[model samples]
Target: MKVGVLVLAFILAFFAESLPLGPLYAQLHPDFVALLILYWALSSSQVLSYFGIWLIGLVQDLVLGDLPGSQAISLVLMLALLYGWISRVRHLPSWEQLFFVFFLLLAQCLSAWLWHAWVGPIRWHSSLLLGPALGAALWPLLTYLLDQLQKHWPRRKTP
Candidate 1:
């Protein structure tokens, strides 16, 4: 059931990323897929393995039509760093967690941007910098909604 929810969230995020918002609004849009990956990585139970993160990144890369491995690398690296310190991060205060999430989102976006720039043409624009900030800002809301959904999910009985 948890896996089902995660898959649904990933699908929703994939479609959301492709929404036809104008250029400025699109740049400001949060990277929902990255946030979902981060959320699962930070959970008490490891819901996604390294391979799962890589697969999600690959799907994101395909959906966005970017260089094949750019997003996969960024996401896998971010998950590696988070999973390594999940014990410590899970104990931090909410505000501090948000701060950390900001940097994580920023790093993911920056890495992807760098990859794109390295392989192909991309115009310099301030909006490019807005994505991570926007994603960080949306973190609380996303967390709350996912928490509610998880709490309400039916649990299986253990024999």
Candidate 2:
């Protein structure tokens, strides 16, 4: 059931991100997939393997028509960073947590940018910062909603 909800959320996020919001809106649009990946990495790390993270990135790449494997690599890089500090970070207050998430999102953006620059010329965009900033701003709300959803789920009894 947890897995189902997670998958559904990712699918919805992917669609939400792909919506045709025009040039300006699209530029400001947050990377929902990256947001979810960070959320789950902190909230339910056991549910997602490294390979699964990589696969999600690939799916994102395909959906967004980005260079193949670029998103996968970026996501994997974000996941690596998250794993090291998730224990301490998750215990922080929401405001502090926001900074950590923002850093992770920024790192993901930089990784993707560097990857693109490595492959070809890079056209730096304001959206690179805007998207992650928006995503970090949305983190508290997303955490609240997802926490409520998790609270509503039925728990299995331990023997």
TM-score per candidate: 0.88, 0.90
Which lDDT tens digits does candidate 2 get at residues 6-85?
A: 87789899998788889887778778998888888777647468898899899999998889888899999998998888
Where does model 1 exceed 4 Å of error? 156-159
Per-residue CA lDDT of model 1 for 1-159, tens digit only, reads 287677777888899987888876678897889988887777647456778788888988899886898889899888777776778887775556777788888888878888889998887777656888888788778877888888887787899
Best by TM-score: 2
Q: lDDT of all the models against the reference?
A: 0.80, 0.85
